[model samples]
Target chain A: MKSLIDFGAVKIYIDCSVKLAERNINHLYPSYVLEDNTVPPDYFVSLKYGGGIRRFVRKQVLFEQDSKSHFKPVPENHAYASFEWGLNYVVSNYAQEFLTIHSGVVANNDKAVIFPAPPGSGKSTLTTYLMGLPGWRLLSDEMALMLPETSYIQPLIKPVCLKNNSIDIAKKWFPDGKFSSIASATAKGDVAHLSPPASSWQQRDRVAKAKAIIFPKYTPNKKMEIYKLDKNQGFMQLAENVINLSLQGERGFNTLTHLIENTEQFEILYSDVNEVKDFIEQDLL
Target chain B: MSKHKISSQQLFDLLADSQNALDLSDSDWVDVIRIFRSESVLARFACQLEESGVITQLPSYATKHLANAKLVAQRQVSSVRFECAEILHIAKNTCEKLYLLKGAAYCLASLPVSKGRTFSDIDLLVTKDVLAQTETSLKLHGWLSEPLSKYDEAYYREWAHEVPPMKHSGRGTVIDLHHNLYLPVSGRAPKVELFLEGAIETDGFHILRPAAMTLHAIIHLMLNDDLKHAFRDLNDLHLMMTEFSKQAFWEDLLDLAHKSGFENELFLACRYCRHFFKTSISTEYLTKLANMQNMNQSEIKLLDRFYALALSPKHYLVKRASANFAELVIITRAHLKKMPIKILLYHTAYKVYRSAVESLLGKAFFEKSNS
Candidate 1:
């Protein structure tokens, strides 16, 4: 039960003994090229049921890096989530080559629109909406991998984590979109994962130059409003939202400045998905 | 001495000769990167490779990691400078000569060991007579003492060489203040004055001279409790040995060790450095130190096994079977050397009890224990 998943910039070898892990791998990483397990990977991760007798009795699955326990254990049913998080953890910490951002991204014609926001800011929900649009494609739901040297945002196509009320909204909006079984009473309060369309997965390796940097805020019953942002302020905001900004240090600062200078920056306040979509189509281009 | 493991030797060779790194496979590069990152020597490796201009010859993927590491290291150097400045400001009014030790000393001295190596806490040494005043000065400057149990506090106050670590209330930088080189409870206590005799002053602060500094680094490595960061410390020794390998430096180092009654520690350091990193120590002084220390070949062979395994990088990706066992032996020996049999018994009992209570109570106790 070992599989090598090549995620363009990084590759991981996952060893799991559970069906949930396999299902998630198939559903989320549809375009990942499978390789022989013997091929050395950047990280050798294991998602398995173990954590002494108590954990075993409770049917918990722990994520391990290089056979050593890492992070905390989750229930066996959430093995996929643990594996996903473990991969994200390794990338955020070890992917020093990229300035990892906490953002959702959508691309059109290889031009990326990065939506950097804090939690509960409708980042993923907006990304899901943009991804559903005819001409737009999902680049990432979280973790915008910005290459410092190229100043290009690379795509990492994994399941978009839908949380709380958004999960229902996503299901209602995209009836055909694949959704994982609802993980109830989770840390993020009833989380579900939405698998991006197959076309996005197929283009996962496509790296795109950032065209727009949008910080989105969701407000109920509010009209869609877009505000232009100062380049220096946008740089500060991106730096603050990055996961490994300090790891890249000055180079990261320079890369971010370049990204801000080249890209159109905006702060979008929108409640309706259709109105936001119209604004992006009409004004963002 | 036990021969350095092939992988460890290969790592050193690649570090010493970046040309060798260019020949490595992607898989080998990954292992090297993981090991270097694990031991906090990625920056050191990147510095050497980039200096040699071989990093440009490496695959783009491999070079990216190196470039990123170098960037991170550059920022760390800035942080170290900032921390040092703050400490110097705190000790500005104090009359006691503030001597930077370990990583801080290396940075202050602009030694090769400082390049790309991770800086932890600020270590400052003062004369024993001025230790209390130094502590008070640090506290007055916003360094808060880390709370420890009564027994632990007493252990540090009476037996340890340094005060309990203090954290800056504002910046959260930890600082370890020492009045001596070795613990009083450790059978051998080197005279701090002997070390200060060869001190080098820069700006308002001081660092040990090359010979004394190298000796201190070796002694510090020998007295450590675990295999954690042993490779990094060994690399420090190797860098020091390589940089200050003058005949006069070695003679002065041996003389200082002899004067301080740490000849055995020096002997062990040299032997292990030679065995592990293939550090270039002249045979004349090497043989001389070995003779002066006077340990049998069999004893050296036995200790060599543990030191070799312990000094090698212990990254999970390439962890050796003997690593954990070697670390256990070294930790036990270090504990024995750090405390007398009476205190050791009580300390062991208390630790076991605390662990039991922590395990029984689970998360709450775990948080409390860590806090």
Candidate 2:
């Protein structure tokens, strides 16, 4: 089946076996598919989270298919609203131009901030908080797809995951903000996704040239601190943050070199989101 | 010119059924070899299949060659854990605690089969003050110390980041216990405590999480400067990316690399993964990070070429003489740096002698067969 979603100037066709349901949103066209086997009936869902969120799973299969394939279907009405959220991932990622980055992306009019952090660093929480700012757009909470040739970011514009206290913090910060179903006690701590801002969905394919690379750390009760990194050191730091520099080989290396040469780099350590926001807006902006 | 009609799907199927189909007269080993381009990738695939319980189905001859590959992969996997376990056991026995690095911790925590990556030696990190004790404990376990020339041993003990290699009697495993991640000579190395503080416990083993392991792999690849058979090393990175993606373990991986002082390696790994495995990482993040890393246009092109050549499964079977030459040069450089000049010269001479002997024996055998 074919389903078309308008992502700003680009209309993407999500062709899969799944049934599509169109919402008022510009980019999201959620869909789900059920599997039919001779033995018994089984259900699988494919979701398009925006860029490339397509994935298939059998409800009963786990760990058995690890060696054979990467896709695993979780219980529906869980994690994602429907399988369409996951299907979006597959279609978007299949495109050759976009390289999927494993990080949180938040952007304002002038620049986007990409936070590359290990677990427990509170990057997702920080990303959620940052997108709550008045003018900034939430590019993606999970991945940041950047074009290698142009260094331009295509908007994933998915839901932002906020964990534990961050969920409450987000609710308090933006009472009007929407959220999906809460998924508690996950591997990454208790998780809930903040709804994408209406404006972000409106300009889903808008590409942003990153202006700053921030390595964020959530230190409990620590005063907010931002340290500027030198070009050489920053280059190394950014290189380490990349997902597949070696696979891209020469193209990856050159792209990374160019990215480092052009952007400002810093390490941000903070406990207070409000304080971090002020620093980002007043000093960096 | 006729276009080649080999299908990847067909090759994959043939590889899957090579053992049962071995009786077919048309099923030649050359065709099997041609389907797989890189020995390393074939080796990795064979090892993975073997680990997954399909080894018995492979042709016996193919299995024998793959056994060496499996051994290498296993050794790499085991070296990490074995060294970490040995060190930890020693430290616990002696009331001194130590921290495990990268692969050692990862294998211990999650993947039992990861012990397949061939490691020449086990690597351990201990406090500088406890180096003597660690060495003594290792020796007590029947590990024979390789005689490093006096000056080199002194440098290793006093000024270098790690100790000389030691071999175990029972398993013939080698160990390279270290006090630091990078050479102290680098002037700006992160403190060992950074890794120690982040060590996680899983399945009764304390190991580096995904992040630390990714950083460790990157640091090892970047600092060695020995790209000999580096195509294999690239394969290892690809394997890690593919396996890790199954768990959706990207964020943790990136974070750990950043924390461990190898952020560049993480980006490079992600970029390489995208280029080779068709992994689902974001391009925006890759380019943004690449730009942040200062990878320019020309460097990007080179990386892509290297990735395409190194990672393609098609390259594993059809041998390229130039790649072999490049690998030889790299190996020679790495060996020469580590060995004494006289020893290096002697080894070179011995290699030549061995090659001459093999060539003479082959010629005689061929003549006999013809007669």
Candidate 3:
């Protein structure tokens, strides 16, 4: 089935196999996907299984964009995961008009807060918890795209990808949260995706202004601690999370300095979601 | 390199006039942009739009892609200058002059073809005697050759025109240091001194003189078998030909190619440029080239038949059934032109043997998937 998915940032045509589509229990795409075939998608992506001897054995699913295979195929069961990662790769390379920073982002009243963290930092877990608040909006779970020289950060409301133990944690935190079944024994370990709140999709076109930069570090059984970063430290840390900073050249530097100079910057070490939420709700946003 | 089918009609129209892009349907525009991106020539098209002020009139979606590509192109221009400066700083110790080549040279010297141009590695030429010293100096400055198999190392050190590509340890910048113009074992490699004589220094950046550089660009395109980038390479030729089209340029280019035994390559390049891009070639020069390289209408026609299919974007959407046959013809000819029978046979046999072993072991075992 070839369907158009309007990701807000870029519209893509996804042609997927029946089995893979069936496995996507969340119906990941919005209803408008069926109505937009008349307009060509900015990207055309396909997910198909590699046919041959592996068909009877452990099948493999190949992800292609415009019929160009950028990455090797993964096992058949990992199709959805592979597709999401492939989309990430494409956006990171092709979407250079914005200063794309690798982070978990959520917004409140048009003000965006970035949670930039490395893997195993419980970034998505915290982002999921923050959105559970009454007025929080999910900007993106993976990256935040900011227009250069402006504080405007585009909202990309994709499913929140939680890895390993964080998968169960997110599910426990939001009982009514709709999530796909877990994919086990994968490269990033057991993985699941938590669909964003309905309101996030409703305001998908909203561009949030940058208000704060938060770096979260999840320590095992550690009390929540927040530390304010100096101007130099904040700017350098923010630049480290940027995907296309090198490609942006001097404009990237100007954007970062301007952003860090205006926004409140802090690094938080937190294990408790409740404490992190209180800090974001009461002190930050 | 990725092999995909592409509709070259879009590219042909856009290369001739950026305004043609506006006439494409949204679906067709998608294919054209992706193909140009894959071929590393989107920046050129983007440049055309930006320069002609057509960029402002396109849809936001189209304008965004162009805006993004133009930024990438600008970065490449700056990056080339920085990498060249670093190379010169290190090479100045032992090598007297560092002659930039291809994309790097174009950008540093600010040539017309330099607009929206980007390339993978920086290519530099030096005196053959000082090649070892320059390599050592580069090594001391942290530009080390990537680990290659013993056979591959032997190929680069002994048979290849350039040394093993040296990459900066920290910066990850790759540099291809060349002492000669072609594979020495190919029996048609040019003497390094002849090209060096025509080198000129522009604003402290040493580059081959316009005519010699044009001939070198032609040889670089025609001698290579990689049809994947041939279309973009042809466009580069078109830009240079338009920028340097004068009686003096044609005479100087021919004289250099004749001296270097690359007249056949030059003739083929001009023929394809005219065929694909409708590049303006003076009739006087065209006749002179035909006479210089033996006049062979039938052979030229046959090569044209192959290139017509092989040189377009390798996307499957535009591929004909016979494109594969044309590619095989072009590849076989390219390999034959690049190496002697003895070396060519060894290289082919080694590749076949390795692939057979790899397949037996399971080719997927070697592939790394992004998860």
For lDDT, the strongest prediction is: 3
**Where does the lowest 10-residue lDDT sum fall in candidate 2 chain A?**
A34-43
Each model's TM-score?
0.90, 0.41, 0.92
TM-score of chain B of each: 0.93, 0.65, 0.93
For residues B1-371, could you state the per-residue lDDT of candidate 3 as single tens digits?
35343357657768877877766655566677777877778888888887887777777767777778888888878887888888887788787788888989988878878888878889988878899999899999999999998888998888889999999999898999998888888888998677777688865557898888888888887887667778788888999998989879888889999999988888988888887788899778887898899648898899889888877777666677898899889888989988988989999998788777555544454455445
Report lDDT per candidate. 0.80, 0.56, 0.81
Reference A-B contact fraction recovered by candidate 2 = 0.00
At residue B295, candidate 1 shows an lDDT of 69
Model 3, position A199: C-alpha lDDT score:
81
Q: How accurate is candidate 3 locally (lDDT)?
A: 0.81
lDDT tens string, model 1, B28-80? 77778777876788889989887888777787767777777777777777777
TM-score of 2: 0.41
Best by DockQ: 3
B19: Cα error in model 3, Å? 3.8
